[model samples]
Target: MNGMKIQITAELLDGLVLAILKQDDYYGYALTQRVQSVIDISESTMYPVLRRLKKNGDLTTYDQPFQGRNRRYYQLTAAGEQRLQEILRLWEQYKDNLDQIFYQRGEQQ
Candidate 1:
């Protein structure tokens, strides 16, 4: 993972957020951390993504009383689930295409 930076597009970020939320609900910080676990991103970056997803009706939020204040948790809507499926399918195809080019060359070595 050293010196390797993978570019994250808006579509990829949306797909990652949706995929993470599909596993379970998470607060903004936790969600940001979860994404950071896989890819390097800041809370600043994630908050906008969350807002966009919610604005698009792909995600919904609920407030939960935790510690002292209300913690906002994000969950996927039905539309989000549909989007996840579509993104996953597209990602698989994209990966296959990339592999055909990248991996084929590796085979010769």
Candidate 2:
């Protein structure tokens, strides 16, 4: 699987970001790092997603002074929570469907 590229859709990206924020607020860099730890994505790809989520009212931001500089943190809004729940439900259904196909096919073979 080395060097294999996995394409992550925008819906999944949004869900991942929202899920992370659900745990705690994070600055842009930290958020991008956290997401990259799980999925291969560049900061350039992440910022626009953050902007879209914020624009959609699914997230909010705040600036906290850190070492004389303000660190902007992204937090999940109530709407974000709802959206996360919807995403999770859909993910579960999708996973289950794939699992059934994969496992059942193997068992039949």
Candidate 3:
């Protein structure tokens, strides 16, 4: 109900988490922030995706002590990383096609 109202289904949220995991390992808050940068979903909506990824063995977590707190850090497993790479390649392809359709091309990175 807040932020941008994009039609994000469950699968898309999973994809978003996988996207961030591709870039770097992150704690819950950090992952939440990173995903928010891409899609305006809130922490509540995002946490379950992380949990589901860990549940489905696409992600792994370790507890690390930092800043006087023990935080659970999320990282992609080999399978998860592979999935990210595959999805990224597909996304790049989609964007390319979309740009051509929009036809106001300068360049996008």
* Model 3 quality (TM-score): 0.73
Give the top-scoring candidate (TM-score).
1
lDDT of 3 by residue, 27-64 (tens): 99998988878677888987888888898888999999
User: Which of 1 and 3 is ahead in lDDT?
Assistant: 1
Is candidate 2 or 3 superior in TM-score?
2
Residues forming the 10-long window of minimal summed lDDT in candidate 3: 1-10
Go through the candidates in order and give the C-alpha RMSD of each one to the true structure: 2.6, 2.1, 5.1
Considering lDDT, where higher is better, how would the candidates rank from best to worst?
Answer: 2, 1, 3
In lDDT terms, how accurate is model 3?
Answer: 0.82
The residue ranges of model 2 lying beyond 4 angstroms of the native Cα positions read: 1-3, 105-109
Cα lDDT tens digits, model 1, 1-109, are: 4698989889999999999999999999999999999998888999999999999999999999999999999999999999999999999988988997977843554
lDDT of each: 0.94, 0.95, 0.82
For model 3, state the Cα shift of residue 28 in Å. 0.4
